[model samples]
Target: MAIFLTGVTGYIGSYLAAELLEQHGESLNLLVRAEDSQEAQRRLWRSLQLHFGFPVFHEHLSARIRIFCGDLTSPRFGLNDEKYDLLVSSTDSVLHCAASLNRKSEKSCLNVNLRGTLEVIQLARRAHDAHGLRRFSEVSTVAVAGQRRNEQVTEDSAIDWDRSDYDPYARTKKFGEHLVRELLPDVPRTIFRPSIVLGDSRRPETTQFDMVRAFVFLGGLPVLPFRPDDCVDIVPVDYVADAIVTLHQSPRPKYEIYHLSSGVNSESFRELTAALAEARGKMKPLFWPELEAPFRAIVERLSRRRDNLGYTASRLEVFLPYLVWNTVFDNTRVVAELRRAPAPFSSYCFSLFRYAKENRFRYPYREWPEIATLPSTARDSEYSESARHVSAGEPAK
Candidate 1:
C-alpha cells in the first residue's frame, strides 16, 4: 500500500521518512512544503544525509518517492485539483506528523496544530471516499495531559483543560485530538502521543535541540528548581519513529491511542544530572525549591552575566513548567503492541551530551565559540576545569 506522509523535514518526520522508504520503497508520497518540487527534494535529501548519515540514499530517492510541495494549513494541502485527486487516489495511508511546536504563542500553535490537523483530517476523508484508505496515523504529544503534576498519565487520561493553564503547544494538540475524534469518528485512525523525544540512542544525532536537549544545557547551571526524584519521561527520536511506523503497519483496531514514551524506565532529575555530569566530567547541579529566594536571586544575578550559565539559566526559566512537574506517562499499550521495551535515557544521555558539546550544541549553526566562552567564577569552577582539561589535550576529569 502507498503512504502519504507529512513533516518530511521535521525531526521525527525525517527519520520516519527514511524508515518508511526503507520498508516500502517507491510506494511513498512525501508532502513537503517548499518553493517547488526541486527545492522540496533537495531539502529532503539534505535532511536524510544530515540525520541519517547516508548521502547515498539520494541516488535512489527520486525513483522511490514522489515529493509534493505545499502547505498543510491550506485546503487539499494547497495542491491543485488534478494533483489533489491524484494524491487521494494513489495513497492508501495518511501519516499526519506536521505541526507547529511554538510553545509561546497560542495563535501560531492553533494555526498549525489545530487548523492544520483539520485539513489533514479532511484529506483523510477524501482519500477514504475516493480510494480505499487503510490507515490514518496522527502524531500527537503526551503533553496533552497538560499540567497534571505528580499524576500517572495513562493512554486514556482525560485532558484536564479546566484545572491548569497548559503551554500553547500542548493546548493546541489537545484541541487537535478532540477535532480528530469528532470528525473522523468512524475512520481507521490511530493517535500516537510521544513524550519528550531526545536524540538517537545508537548515534549522536538530533535534528533539533529543544526541550530534551535544553535539560542537558541546564546541567551547567549551579542551581535548578527540581526534585531529585521528579520523573522526566524522555524517549529517543528513533524509538518514537520506529514505534509509530510499526503500529501503523500492523493491522489493529479501528481507533487506538498509544503513549510512545520511556514510561517506567524514565529517569529522574538527579539521574539525568548525574549522567550529564559524568559525561562532562563535572559536578552535578544542585536542586533548589522553585520559590527559593536565594536561588531566584542567584538566577537573576547570573542572568546578567555574559556567559553560557547565564544564558542557559534564563532559557531554563522559560521551560520551568516542564522541569517542575513530575508526571509519569503510561506506555503499557505501546509495550504490549511492540513487544519490546524502550531504551532508557541513561544509556544514551552521555552520547547526546558529547555530541552536543562537540558540535557546540548548534549543529548546523556552529556558533559554539560565542557560547562556549565562560566567565571565571566560583560557581563555574567545574565547567572551567572541564574546559581547561579538554583544551590541554586531556580527557575531562
Candidate 2:
C-alpha cells in the first residue's frame, strides 16, 4: 500500500520523504502546493538536491514519487473528485508534516497548523474507513509545552494554554494536537514531537536556516541575555527523520506521543557558545542575566535605526525567550521505541555552526552582503566593550 505525505518541501519533511521513498519505493504519494505537476516535481527535486547535495539519486527517487499538487488548507486537499477518490482508495497511511512556523502571524499559524491539521485528520479518517489504513503519523513540536519552564517536559506533559506569553506557533500546535486527539479518538495514530531540529549531523546541508541560524548569528553579539545552565534541546535532522520513520514502521503502541529530542543530552547555552566559538575561532560569547532589560532596550533603539543591527535585533527579540528557557524535554518513549538514543547535541552542534557560517546563514536564498557583515558603528563598539566586561564576570552597567 502507498503512503500519503505532506510538507515534502520543508526541512524535515524533505528528509522524511527521502527516507520513506528508500523504504517504500514507488508507493509514496507526496502532497505539494504548486501551480501544476511540473512545478511540484521541480520543487521536490530542488528540496532533495538542497538537502542531499547530489544529483545521482534524484532520478531514481523522482521516478518513485507521485506528486499531487494541492493545498492541505482546502477540503479534499483541493483535489478534484476523481483525484480525491483515487487518493482515498490508493493510500494506506498518512504522514502529515506540513505546518506554518511563522511566530509573528497568529492567523496564518492557526490557519495552516490548526485548520490544515483538521484537513489532514479528515483525510486520515477517510483513508482508515475506506482503505484499511494502518497508521496516521503527524509531526509536531515539543514547544507545545509552552512556557512551562524549569521542568521536565515528557511526552504526556500537560499544555498550559492559559499562559499569556506562549509563542503563537507553540500555542497553535498545542491546539492542533488537542483537536487531533479529540477528533480521531480511535485511529491508530502517532504524534512525534521534535525539539529544535538543526542541520544534518552527517552532512553539512539544511533546507532552511531559521531558528538555529538565528541563534548562531546572535553569538556574534557582545552580550546576550541568557543563563549559563539553561538547556537547549536540539536534535539533528537525520536523527529526527530516522526516528520518525522507524517509529512508523514499528508496531503501533498504546501510547502515541513521542519526543524526538536530545533529552538528557541537551546542550546548554554555555556549551553551545563554546562549540560555536571553537568552530568560528572566536571568543566565546558572554551570557549575562542582568543584560536582559538593557539588551531589550538596545534592540528597541536599534530597531529604529533601520540598519543591520536593527534587523538582527528585531529577529533576536523573537527568539530571546529561548535563551533562558529552562525546560528539558524527556524522550524516553522515543528512546525505547527506536531501541537507541538520539546523538548528543555536542557531537553535531559544530557541524551546524559550520554549515550556518559557510552558507552565510541563509540556505536556498542568496546572501545579502549588507546584512551578512556587522557594521562597525559606535553602538557596536559599545556592545563589544560590554561583552568584554560580561566575559570578565563584571556587570554590564
Candidate 3:
C-alpha cells in the first residue's frame, strides 16, 4: 500500500517527502517530470541532498522508494495506458501536490491548479474503483481563505467571498479543492491550507518566497518607510510539513479542510522593517515622524486618480495598497488538533536579518535591478577587489 505522490521536486514537496520517509517509511511512488532517466536520478539525488544532506537519502529508507515521470497537465498524468492501468490497480493513497505556481495569469493557473487537479481525481476515482485506495490528499493554500479582513478566521468560518473563483492563484487552489470534493465523495480526503510558507526554521535551507524578500528589500534601502499598522501573516515550512504528517497519521475526520498556519505571530510592516534593519543593516530605529504628515499629504494628492502618478510615482502607487492595509488569518482547528505537535517556527525578522547581514549572506529576496547601479560603499569595494585575486591570496595550507 504505497502513497502515490506528486510535486516531489518542489520546495514544499521536497520537505514533505523527507518527513514522510521518516514517519510513513518509503512506500511511495513519486511523480516527477524529467527529460530522461539520468536527469531524473540526478534531480532526485540533488533534492535528497538538500533535505537529508550529502550521503544522498537518509539510511534504511532509500531502497523503499520508486519514481514515476509525467506532466500533471496531461491526461492519465501523461503515462501510457498500460502503466496508468498498473498504477490504477496498485496504490492506496494519492497525495496530489503538483500545481502551477505561476502568478502571471488566471488561465494558466486554472489549467494546472484546477484542471490538473481534476485529472488527479479522475485517476483516483479509477484507482479506487479498481484497487480500493484509501484516501486522497491535497496541498492547498491559506490564500483560499481569500482577501478576508479579520482575525480568528476559523476552520468552520464560511468562505464569505469566493475569492478563489476570482484571483488566479486562489481560484486554482479553490477549484482544485472543488474537484476533489465533487468527484470523490466516498473516498477519504484531507485538504491542507498553509499560509505564506517560509524557509526552514532550523537548517535555514529554503526556496519558499515572500516575507524574507520584503524584509531584505527594506534592509537594502537607506530609509525605512514607516507605516506602523499594516501586517502580514508568516508561517514556517516545517510547520506545514509537520501538520500534514499529523493529519495523515491521525484518524482524520472526513472531508476536513485544515488551515495549517501559525495562528499567531502577526508582524506589522513597520516592526518587520525594524527587525530587518536591526538584523542585517545594523541600522538604528529612527522612525521619521517629522516626515509623516508631508509624506501623507504627497500620497493623498497623488491618489486623485489611478493614473495620476507618473512612472516612478505610479510604481510606488501600485505598491502602496499593500503597505497601508492587510488583515489576519486564524488557525484554531489545526492548532487544537496539533496542541502537542511541534509548532511551526517562523524567522524572527530581527534574528534572521541580523544573521544574514552579519554573515554577509546574499539578500536574495531583494530584487537586484539596481545592485550594479548602487555605488560601492566603503563596505564592499576593497573586499570585492581582493576577493577576485585567488593567485595573490594563497590558500590556507
lDDT of the candidates, in the order given: 0.73, 0.73, 0.61
lDDT of 2 by residue, 1-397 (tens): 5788889889899888888766654367778888665456457667776544333333443345566768878887788877787778878888889999887789889889988999888888888888577888889888788776777787875466676545788888888888888987877788989887876778766667666556666767766677878898878888899988887776666468888888887888888778777877888877787877887788667757686556666666666665567777898887777787877666777777677777776676422122112222213001123223333345434
Clashes of 1: 0
- Evaluated against the true structure, the overall lDDT of model 3 is 0.61
What's the residue-level lDDT of 173 in candidate 2? 89
Give the higher-TM-score candidate: 2 or 3.
2
For candidate 1, write residues 110-130 as lDDT tens digits: 889988888888888888887
Backbone clashes in each candidate structure, one number apiece?
A: 0, 0, 4
Pick out the ten consecutive residues of candidate 1 with the lowest summed lDDT. Answer: 375-384
The CA-based lDDT of model 1 is what? 0.73
Locate the minimum summed-lDDT window of 10 residues in model 2.
374-383
For TM-score, candidate 1 versus 2, the one ahead is: 2
Q: Tell me the TM-score of model 3.
A: 0.74
Count of backbone collisions in candidate 2: 0
lDDT of 2: 0.73
- TM-score, every prediction: 0.84, 0.85, 0.74
